[model samples]
Target: MEEKSGSLVEWLAPLAFILCAGWLTWHLPAFTLSWFPPKDPSQYDKLSALFARIDVTDSMTGLFGGYADAVDWAALLLLPVFGIIGVRTVRRAPMEFESWKPLDRLAVFIGRLTMMLIVLLCSVMIYEVILRYVFEAPTLWANELSLWLAGFVFLCAGLYAMQQRSHIRIFLLYDMMPRWLQRVCDIISTTLIVTFAFFLVYGGYGEAFDKFYRWETFGTVFDPPIPATLKPMVLLVMVLVAFQAIVNLISDWNAEPVIHTAADDIDQDELDRLRAAVGADGTGDLDVTRGSIQSNTPGKS
Candidate 1:
């Protein structure tokens, strides 16, 4: 029962989170921006834009007519609910966490979110393919939607990778260095990352804000705010990556140094499974080394 509940939560939570996020993206700002007077010559001039960027008046119509914004309220509710579930369900992945404390419930959640996004992206593409090829009724939204989801998948995965310490690193020289020197190298790398994030956020914040405020979009028939959403996300994800790097540095400060080699890429469990499948006969010639699998044509060395 517990496993089933966890599986369901993992599967549905991300979908709900994405839907709620999309709803909030459309409706939340409309209310929050109420302090400022409405502007003219807006992107909301287009019907597609209006749908993408729900106006204060438009949001209250239809099923949401009785409430301030039914969808928005629901979105607000579901976002935190799923997020809390994520936090609760997250487990310590010590292998990935390595020297760090693995206080990465948030990263685990986003990692699941990325998994969900990949599913959604594939669904969108498959939908597009079927509709276009079979039914001859393609959608204008599907391509842009895939692109939009792909953007978040990349960003979220980066943060998750940071938490896992799985991001690419050339440790050849660093592994040979003394502990103090390795610490210095870590500081330098972290500082560079922080510096880059700072400059990028500082410089691009204005543009991200402008795009978000205007609800700038791809201008296709679907007219998604890819520019608005992804621009801000780039800065947001960079900050997160930088923060995670700092956390890693702090947690691993007193830890012994780690060395990497091609052998690290091999999965013992996977080899076990493969050997089981191949049987004892073929296993005699099977060898795993330097991240490569070697075999003889059975009865040969």
Candidate 2:
């Protein structure tokens, strides 16, 4: 699953890149407008004269011209596609563990929390719409509020997906392997995913730092410096997720007695005891009748 984790990091790297790009656009919205703006503009030059030749009329044309709004919304739509791809990948695997550890439980709890938050966000939006259309008393905060909640949803749910292990896979050969071969394959997969996640966090640190320094904010009414706030959280969650993956991988690899599904339901300890009583390979002078209980006396072995 480390490879899957790596894939997710790769998928999300673009979003981080776009965030940095938004910062650039925020600083130089007009620079992007010209096919090639003059490298040097005089202090006295009018802003209009700079773009005088271009006939761009959209709201995003002018300096600070709502480009952030457009990009942010576009990203909001694009992100979920990658997320969906990551999720479907993991759902294809069979259930691995019979019981989960503490971190696994925590991940499930976080998932539930995020689900509730989404529901709450939807309810708020519905109420806002009713207020606007029915009574013509629209609130300015609703839209911004939705955006804020959306940031949380995006971040928290991504972590939840990691815990759920529903990321992508190239399992063309995995299904064909023997049980021991499959275990080895799982070990390799887990190692790769952890490695990838480590590098993702390492590489993203600089971009996240730059965003934080700028105190980056959404342009609209919410006007929160959410990029700065949320970027670090994403990195942190990735690290935590990587740690959880490693833990789960280790547990799976080093589990005691190697439980198997096709084996009978009898306790291994009891089976071993019966085997000892019956003699090595059951070939020596013991009763061969079926359904006969062997008598156990003190010091029989």
Each prediction's TM-score against the native? 0.80, 0.48
Candidate 2, 1-301: lDDT as tens digits: 2222224444343344344433443333244323333344542143334233222333453334432344444544555554443333322123333325666655544454476568768988998999999989998778876877788778778767766655555555765666678778877877886788788888999989766544456666645556766787688877777777776676666544333343445666666656755777764334433344544657654
What's model 1's overall lDDT? 0.74
**Leading candidate by TM-score:** 1
Q: Which candidate tops lDDT? A: 1
- 241-301, model 1: which lDDT tens digit per residue? 8988898889788987878778788788877766765557774333443233455469643
Candidate 2 residue pairs that clash: 2-193, 3-193, 90-166, 90-167
Looking at candidate 1, the ten consecutive residues that score lowest on lDDT are: 59-68
Candidate 1 local lDDT, residue 144: 90
